[model samples]
Target: MKVCLVGSSGGHLTHLYMLKPFWQDKDRFWVTFDKEDARSILKNEDVYNCYFPTNRNIKNLIKNTALAFKVLKHEKPDVIISSGAAVAVPFFYIGKIFGAKTIYIEVFDRIDKPTLTGKLVYPITDKFIVQWEEMKKVYPKAINLGSIF
Candidate 1:
């Protein structure tokens, strides 16, 4: 199956990368920030680098949303997965409209609180996987798949 693996750089992308064992064999492409780590790790993969500073900035969100739409249209992935910072917001929501099965993996660091990306993507996501049981309290419907670390 074709997969669109997406997330921001740093830990979010790190968590997404943990799933490489599962998705590496699948037909896949990535959508993420153009940061050093992402470029270094995904160097040999099909990567679509997107804009950053997506922390509720209307202008950047709009721009990224358009980029998300364009990439989803072109790739037509069967599944779109992300462990986010902020960029996953536009990608998941827009990809949902395009009929891609959207999966959002809550980060491992968050225990006391939920990330804004998790809260925003939950409603539209097909599967919301939490790394901690405490998160199940925050996201009741979320699947507690334990730590991705």
Candidate 2:
């Protein structure tokens, strides 16, 4: 199976990395934003960088959309998994439209409060995973997968 492991920089990527073993036997690719930390993590993997806008305002949504299309066209992954802050929105949306199974893994920090991405992607996600069991309170259907790191 072809997989596109997509996420923003920092903790989001770290969480996804913990699930690396699952992709060890599959055809996988990494799609992440360009950040100094992201550069370090992607060093030994097949990776594609996407323009991750610093601003989350409405003005930059169009550019984010374009970047999403670019990555979707090039990768053509059968499944797209993301630990998101902002960039995952476009990736998940475009991946779904392209007939890819979209999986959303909520960030680890959301033990007490619901994150923006979690709320937005939960209902639409083909698979919704949470690191904390308490998250099930916020998203009743979320699967508790424990800590990734």
Candidate 3:
């Protein structure tokens, strides 16, 4: 299966890395902002750089739209899994439009409250996995996977 692991750097990247082993034999690609840490970790793998906005900037939105088109055309992943902050938004919707199976993993830091991307993508996501059992209260359909870390 071709899988696109989309997320921001830092903890989101860390969480995605933990799931890498599961797809070792499958074709998987990573997408994140072009940050040093993100580039360093994903150096050995297939990586796509997408601009992420600082706020809700229009320029970034345009950049992301172009980037989304590039990703959809080049990667053509069969599935998309995201543990994200903001960048996941465009990728998630693009993946859905392309008829890819989308999976959303609520971040580990969001045990008490839901992340915006988690809530936004819930309805369209094929699978919703949460690290905390408490999250099930907020998203009843989510599967508790403990923590991939």
In model 3, the Cα lDDT at residue 138 comes to 91
Which digits, one per residue and each the tens of the lDDT, describe model 2 over residues 1-149? 89988877888888778887898788898877788888897888888776656346565557767877887888789998988877777778888898999889888878967888777777778999888988889888888988877
Residue-by-residue lDDT tens digits, candidate 1, 1-149: 99999888888888889897999899999888898999999999999988877887889899999999999999999999998878899888889899999989989989858999999999999999998888888999999999887
Q: Could you tell me every candidate's TM-score relative to the true structure?
A: 0.97, 0.90, 0.92
Q: Among these predicted structures, which one has the highest TM-score?
A: 1
Local distance difference test values of all predictions, in order: 0.90, 0.82, 0.84
Candidate 2 local Cα displacement, residue 142, angstroms: 0.8
Residues 1-149, candidate 3: write the lDDT tens digits.
89999888888888888886777788989888789999888888988887775236668767776777788778889998888867777778888888889888999888879887788788988999999999999999999999887
Ranking by lDDT: 1, 3, 2
* Per-model RMSD to reference: 0.8, 1.6, 1.4
Model 1 deviation from native, Cα RMSD in Å: 0.8
Question: Which ranges in model 1 have alpha carbons more than 4 Å from their true place?
Answer: none
Count of clashes, each model: 0, 0, 0
